[model samples]
Target: MSIKKSPESWAPNADQDLGPVLILEPEEGKNFWQPQPANGHISVRISPDFLDVQTPFSLGTQTLPAGGYVREHSHPEHDEVLHFIRGTGKAVVDGEEHAIVPGKTIFVGRNRRHMFVNSSQDELHWVWFIQPNGLEHFFEEIGREMVVGGEDPTPFPRPENVLEIEARTAFAPQPADQRKPD
Candidate 1:
């Protein structure tokens, strides 16, 4: 099967003229990951900026290293769906733990705390979508851009104003008991 390109390409350039369509190779999208202690990264494939739409959703891919995890957190205004693509892991959502494997889809409703922990030796990969858009902006504020692909994974220093950013986005943090493994 072959995929057809859109009538107009929307890739950004210095000129900043908006195009009718945006065509992006996987690598062309903005890439970012949580700094240290968070354990994974994401490649944002589509967002409002990328699509030039007022839609309230964003799409991206994430990879979690073995033994790595995303700390428990919640989006007060958005719901999230995670579709596992590779490897094995576990998702803790709202105090319940569930296995994560290829083809499994996890739904995290708004204000429910959740996190993903990679358990297999291999990396756990998944595609994620969040409703009401704007999560991309949070990622951009909290993460540094991966300028080049396949670079060595290193800890990114936590930004001093992360709490402020999180507050602005209503990204509530879970309590320590809720976030830690039982």
Candidate 2:
């Protein structure tokens, strides 16, 4: 059965680009295998790939295996809001540690340092949304391409040129310790 498009649509995108997702059907978003340590996956839900930055914010969903974590990092040009939708975790935002649980929303301003660690027995899931439209591109650049229902790939490392990718994406992560206050 075919799903009908929403009666109203957002502005059209360039001919080659898909338009903003008014309704995301199954298998609609771009998915990728998250690099090792986290060893999970991310789905780019909405971004400039579909809509203009002036209107649509970038959005993605990520899942992390037990004991997985995201290293400390910062986005110099964009603010981020993460909604903890599943599992429990610990979030460090600018040196402050917070408990993460379902329904908890975390706001990280541009240039603030942060990290997340999953402390649950099950997979941890969250929605990563950012202002000005761009996070999805960063994820895509460092992530290995994967399709929904495909076999999961072996755990992998970040690209050797991850620093360059971070530069291009406005991410400003140094070694976690280096960024912490002395």
Best by lDDT: 2
User: lDDT by residue for model 2 over 85-181, one digit each (tens)?
Assistant: 9999899888888999999999999999888888888989999988866678777888888866678884888889988888887587675374321
The deviation in Å at residue 150 for candidate 1 is 6.6
Q: List the residue pairs that clash in candidate 2.
A: none
lDDT of candidate 1?
A: 0.77
Worst 10 residues of 2 by lDDT: 1-10
- Can you give the TM-score per candidate against the true fold? 0.81, 0.82
Looking at model 1, which ten-residue stretch has the lowest summed lDDT? 1-10
* Candidate 2 root-mean-square deviation in Å: 5.4
lDDT by residue for model 1 (22-63), tens: 667766788886675555788887787665555668888888
Q: Give the Cα lDDT of each candidate.
A: 0.77, 0.78
